[model samples]
Target: SQDQTWNDGGDFDGTNTFICEWDYEDALSASVKEFGGHSYYVFSGDCYTWEEAKRFCENRGGYLAVINNQKENDELYKLMLDFGYESAYFGYTDKEDESHWKWVSNDQSTYENFNKAEELGDVEPNGDTSENYAMFYYKYKNGAWNDGDFGFYTVNSGKAFICEWDYTNPTPYNLNDGNYTLHYTTNLGREHRSVDFDRTYDIDNIATERFTKNYQTDLAYILSVMASSAYTQGDLVYNLITLGFNDYSLFNYYDNPVDERYEEDSCAFSIAKKELSNNSTLVLITIRGSYGGFENGNLLNEHSDWYSNLTIWFPELVGFGSHQGFDAAKDKVFEQLKEELGGDLLKSNVKYMITGHSRGAGIANLLTKEMRDEGVSVYDIFNYNFACPDVAKRNFLRWNFKGKYDNIFNIGIAGDPVSILPGVPGDIISLGGHLIAQWGKYGNSYWFSDNWAEEYITYDTDLHASENYVRMLSNQKDIGNAKNWTQMQGKKVRNVGVDVIVKTTSAIPVLSGLNATITDTNGTPIAKINGNEIEYYTTDNIEINLNEYEDQTSISVNGKSDVIVEFSGIDDTNIEILVVSTSENQNKSETIAYFEAVP
Candidate 1:
């Protein structure tokens, strides 16, 4: 009854479909003209169908219609309303598909066209199951166009449409890597990988292997922690009284037959002296907490903390997985590690490294801290993934790797055990996260063997090993992966003293107050005058800022040629200039002609 003709068919009313036009004086004038106004000149009346209207408009060398943005859309709406027009038809309809309504101009939708939802229980559309098309309606509130459906037809029938166009083209991307190779190894015996050309085939396999290891380790650590209780500060008392466990022990691994918790006389460490007799080429002894034992035949004793022996007591939290714990058993282990690997570990000639996994990992990390604090050169410490509470230590390169779905990633959802320092993200590496599991060292011989010692720790090997594991500890170089890795600042690599020549057409072109300062190979400005020659030092191009002009301007240079001659006062002059090589050491300076200005 309220004119369904305007909803679908072409002929609606005297005001529904109409067009207007105006001639522009220039491009700027044309761009400034607004599309809607109450007294605008109507070029075509309400007489064309959706297709006919488009053809009619485009055939006249113009687009159907374009609403630039939201502001313009509102302006057009207001202008139509002022003209007493209800739902004046524009150049938008779902002729291509009943869904995906778009502008015929380019078949794209802008932010202005998308509709908002109505109030509660109000039958809305386009919710996952509904089609994806823009709609138009009169009395449109909450961004929904009625399309007259809720009032007259079914939910899918009465919808209107609009169109848009983008004049700019898409940008291109970088895609070059010819020097990449997969089998290349650095001087340190560490291998580098590549993902280019034919090597791209191997990338997927490498990615899959890395992903699987990280995923598996995260799953295991989460399960172990979830099945364990939050160990508190005084937990060591109960742990010691039960005799159930000692330092570096997992409660889950103990059986309660006897009340006394005894140390497991596990397999002694295997020590093979390469050439026992007359082999004194600086014996590099590495005294680390390997296999949880020592050379003195001392099996690691369980700690007083029950959380450290989580193999026995586990906690189940609803709507949460596991939590952080703060306790003192950790401190005792730190103290013992310091006493055992004291000066012997930090000797300059001794390539010693202290490392650990699980509780041992936490201890090894702390040892490095204590040694460094005592002014010892204990640079060879690498702690793999450890199941210990949060703590902070610095000046060490640590990396922490986290899995996307690892429950540990949601630690913030639970309660934080300790607050991370400023700029450190709460991820594994930030709070001491690293990818390699406690036992990952066993896979690579170079890791545990002494023959593979380098002056500095082999960063490539560390990176590869860590990348191959579940998560890596935070390191300074890993910027792309971890957030905290970005906070660190170090020496920046730079390329300086690049030489480029500028050709001038005239000799000493009108030097009215023309002046230039120069520098040498080290960017040090040079000052010297020899007879008829002036020696200027700079690899950076010399700039001549011409302020005023003087007729009898005199200038001379040694032999460098990349001098930059500029103009400010006058133009159209050519000069023969001699340049000398005071240019930076990285670049060569040559002599050339100069021009005043481009005529």
Candidate 2:
């Protein structure tokens, strides 16, 4: 073996044949070893160029070994002794900048091991720009590094090289329990908004507040209806104020400004002033979601390195930026609000609430940060977002918003995908294969775990639908009070009456022409047999018109109706009821109520 020589021509010429025996340790060959918490594999068969060798190692899920210290360099030199070769390529290079060497793995290495002096006299790595790559030279002062080129048979010829892999650091999405509180607002009713007057309410109080869940469910439904395309922008504002949102009034609406750059998708927002019972007004800013060209604009606005860079560059903005697109959209929205409300609205007594669904929700998140950074009082601001995306960079969110806003709540459905995307770009990189696992770290998230038996929870965009969110919240009840009730059916009994209630699920106000029908337990239409039909009445005891007959039965009322029924029976009977609304631009009908008939 000592008489043999591995020439640059890839020939083994000498006396006896040499046996390259490699010992085994665990899954690694003796040629493979560990140094500085990284695994390195050395190969010395076929010659390759620097680029070819780099690609060869990359295909194996690693890059050429990057030596960081004298200890590591010495270990690599000892491992090279078995190869019977003078040199091998490693991971050091100054390809980007001739003066500053860099590791192929993108890590910054401070240590260098160039030969101080050579047998020829001067030190190695003296070729300057001509030699951009480095190789470990065995004879140069006991394996010191030498600058080399990529030419074959030359100093940088594709020879044996080491591949390094890092497997020690844990993955980012390990679900470390976050320090913030988690609130499930699915069951809160709308009334809790008005009832909870004290601004001192904390997470614990919100978690345990009575009627809170039901209130939230109601509000979610209302907001979902508001997000529908059924009503015009002006009509939406009027309907919101008219439909029991008496505490709030529209401040102004900002139409998407016209700009040639944003010809595809534009942005719009509306402001509402809530007059609290405590003599203070709360400003609510609601941004509109994708409509027509705006969708294209949102998708085209590429991610920026800085939060406000794009907005600063272009007054007419269209994309979600590092600050989650607030720079383009919210900057204008904030400016409009400040101009409309004047300085008086920024007083300590004036509170602020921001809300939106989809793209609007994303804007709200960034706007919250912008307002807070501008010296706005944190305690006076409350943010409730639905199905929003990760608006800003992870570091920006962690350092700026996380643990800073106590009243902010982000509600998302378990299966919705929109709430988790624009993930670490490239397809090869994922955050533990779950977006929520990464976004959940940024704030207090309220996830609706019950996905209604959705097959693909994460990819189901239907689950992201605003209406479905409201429906799920409305149907969800406290676990302790879960039960089923009975409904009553037909048979006229003297002095016994059934009460009918009509409710509207649309954001558009319905005035009149609402109707109701009664059916038996078997779902068969029923009517009075002999002058004893169901009667329609209002809350003021005023009788309304009804067309009731045994064969053809139907009862019609105005916007809302109260009905009284007379049924003759000795045992309780179940009955079905259906209510239809004739309001324009609204859903046709819905099952209003069901009851049991008592004899």
Candidate 3:
């Protein structure tokens, strides 16, 4: 009964057919026109005033047409001529302001298509303040825009209207459904492997959540109180305790109080154990960097110590020896850890993670290596370090032990100079100059060179700031995968509808054999390959051609080729599409894009 046809007189009947010269269906007779990837539908037998016409289109799930360009205006004129309508109301109006016209749908009218002809001779919009509606004029002006009054005679009676619907708005893929899991992996060269833990799992979930939270807390504790000019080790411990970590209990803390002048250059370590909400225990070790003072070993000491302490020891090979200022702090940390683990306070089953920024990161790196050498399983230890300098020399980096510690991930912000360390010459020299430049200028003019001084002064201080490290890590916590070495994760999945476009940039002409495979999120092909074709599962009624969709089109100006594939019934789900291409003479297939997916 709902599908019965309606006659022209607005009567629904089972037998009579509603016919129009243009396309007609159900109760509405409409004609379609496309321009700039958008489709416009002009409905017939619907003559309503400007307000009524807008409401009619809105009820049908579209707003009145907004012609914002010459292409759209030309298409609309053709649509009107085909329908044989002299004039029809569109979406623009100035009812809100006299001359400030806007589209009724969004109130934005950046492009105006108002008529500018000599024959019309200011006859267009002549009603001025009296007219508020606009219509496409097909008679006197031959497909130009004209203004009309809302209540004036025939115009007030009703007018055919055009409605616009955008089909290109991509539907977002939902991840809440339990059927799929996002898997990500990054290729770290030299047999090193990094896999993103199924975030849905318990172990990874606890590790990531706790690491992000406690790391931020420790950073804030160091910056606000420990790095302050008036900071003392007693003040540092009190402030950390007041921060209120859940189930917090400090196991040990160490700071050397004997060196009073350099005491403010506080290199301290704290180990705390906390119970996670998921009924698991987390052992957190946080190392705090120095406070800002020349006497206290801060940036100046870190730079000088790195170059001065470079050593070439056997077995371990080239390595950076501990700085004299932080040697006491480092020795104290190991001493406390050895004592605490031997006692009944620490457990073997609890998760252990080390975190720090800048100089603290340097200490944490040393602790990780020490723990590993003591026969602690690599799987049991995790390191989340920010702006960590390269502590080990070239030969030490090539060691088997360094390659096996997959759980240690050093997060460096894009422009962080400290992360790249003494390799960044500008930062090292800048630190040196900041500490001794004034002394050279007044006390010993011969100590400084003009060229070296100029270069040091030009270093980018903003890129090496501790605050930047904190900010970058904080922003990365939500999107960065905790289990992976690189910050590539599920957030890269885009909602690009059912149709996916794979673009390849190469100089080769005409990819001969193009094939695609639908895979699960983990890169396992689900479709079976028969000869050169692969079949994907879809619903019973829907029909799709896997071969026809794989045809390539040339985008020569950009030196790229594009291939499109459509996957029906895969809506609202996550899927990986693997596309491969081969040139005419090539025997081996080339993988174009891998790990490309829709969420």
Candidate 4:
């Protein structure tokens, strides 16, 4: 029996019941080391032959590094030198023919470096049969490659090698056109929510859970996508479609997305609406935050955003003067949102929700505060925030919300610095650059750690990245409940993760499943359509034909943790399977990620 431990990534008290959620990939590349579209590593002192090192790299989800140009070659050389290695192996090798060179990662016969001198003549690969491997001799400068026995070591040598890997973000997805595209907003690249947090609490009856859980992830993923400029209003609408909402449209509502600085819409906002089956309305108002990381949006519009984030004032005297930077931003957001959301919020049949991340998260929190001050109760609005900065002075906000902050879902990640910026963590009032130095946030606080890879892919910035929050939320959506709103507080809200999926090592693109059903050969009902082209059902111990459909080539499965999958007639590497186990019992539902490598 094989037992695999899955980290729920909630809290880490370091007991046997809870372990840190990280992987070898995290250990291998959980670094600040990244460059040129790949992760870099300098293996030192692990003396191994060329073949052994090659296998080592492959075993760890990487390859012996390939230096494409002199500049990159110098960079790697410097790194190895910094590690105090006298000699190191690169990807180029000629051991097979003793003359023909090739890159170890790919069998391309391209030779770029060969040691040459003014007098020593043909300094490399001259060892013929004895020296068939190409490596760098740190002693020789001016771009030189030497072919020598990889086992040969000097006192100063660590026998190091450069290893590299590609990040799996923006992974592949299935296209209806029979081609392949990357994981975009259209394809979502997620297991359609494995847990449900869409349970709503009555605003009038505040004795129970106040905030909905699922929206923490929903808004995290959505706000992260909105952080990217690659997406547009169309993408947001498409996201709503994937979330199982219908008849979606972007409602700008006569606002210019006005901000305090450059004309660049720093406080850009939009509203989306869907009609519920009970004649109720569902509204999602999204506020765009500065894309401070690799995201294109914050970089393009950062000047205005930075100017605003640093305002850093907190005085109740300046018209609800709480954390003036965020308060000012909220005012600007309201200028754009007032026309769309300012009117009567008392239509009990309409579910009004406002969400944002980063600066936008602050705006959402403050906007909810202002609305309450304007006579709208917690019963009237659902506000969700993520990667939120300290919004207001602790006492002021704690008092402002009238001890009722459950309608405001304020989410923070464990390693995310932005969420705790402008002050220290958990400190009620901290100093900032303003007159009234007080900083804190108000809302029902929830925290999560990045579940994708256990460590940082970049620097501290990775902790604050929007994508990590989405991936983390994608893993465990029910850590807490932040759900969608409905007309009546008692109305049952549709939960997320109604659909489940099975994942593989991605030999093919991603395959997934919906909550559909059919009968198998056992006269029992097999359920769910897992992916775009191919589909499968959930049950114990099942076998199915992989090539039943000619045009439909994708594969999807719905299964339990102990389910076994056997495939026949579908041996190509391009096929993907999505499996889902939608047992009615919530506790019995486990995340099934079974992967098989195509040999």
lDDT of each prediction vs. the true structure?
0.27, 0.46, 0.42, 0.49
lDDT of 1 by residue, 127-180 (tens): 322333233345463333322221113232221222121222211111234222
Candidate 4's residue-wise lDDT over 1-599, tens digit each?
Answer: 25776546666676756334442223333442566777767775332356656654554457788878777777777776766676778788778876877888774435477777745446666777777777777557655777767755422433677776775321111123322111222112321121222322112122122344224444444444443211233334334443334433343211112222333324556665656656766666677665322121122233355445644434434423466656766776565555554466556676666777677788788888777777666765777677777766536536335556667777666545466454211111112122122445676655664442332211133456555555656564664443221111222212112112222343442322212344544545544333333344444543221211111222223222233344443334543343433222221122234233432
Of the two candidates 1 and 4, the one with more favorable lDDT, higher being better, is 4
**Which of the two candidates, 2 or 3, achieves a greater lDDT against the reference?**
2
Off by over 4 Å in 3: 1-205, 208-266, 276-280, 295-328, 343-347, 396-402, 422-459, 477-599
Q: Is candidate 2 or candidate 3 better by TM-score?
A: 2
- Candidate 4, run of 10 with poorest lDDT: 424-433
Residue 199 in candidate 1, Cα distance off native in Å: 21
Clashes of 2: 37
* Each prediction's TM-score versus the true structure: 0.20, 0.36, 0.32, 0.39
Return the candidate ranking by TM-score, descending. 4, 2, 3, 1
lDDT of 3 at 428: 20
Number of the top TM-score candidate: 4
CA lDDT, candidate 1, residue 188: 24
Instruction: Score candidate 4 by lDDT.
Output: 0.49
- Lowest-sum lDDT 10-residue window in model 3: 439-448
Q: Alpha-carbon error at 78 in model 1, in Å?
A: 99
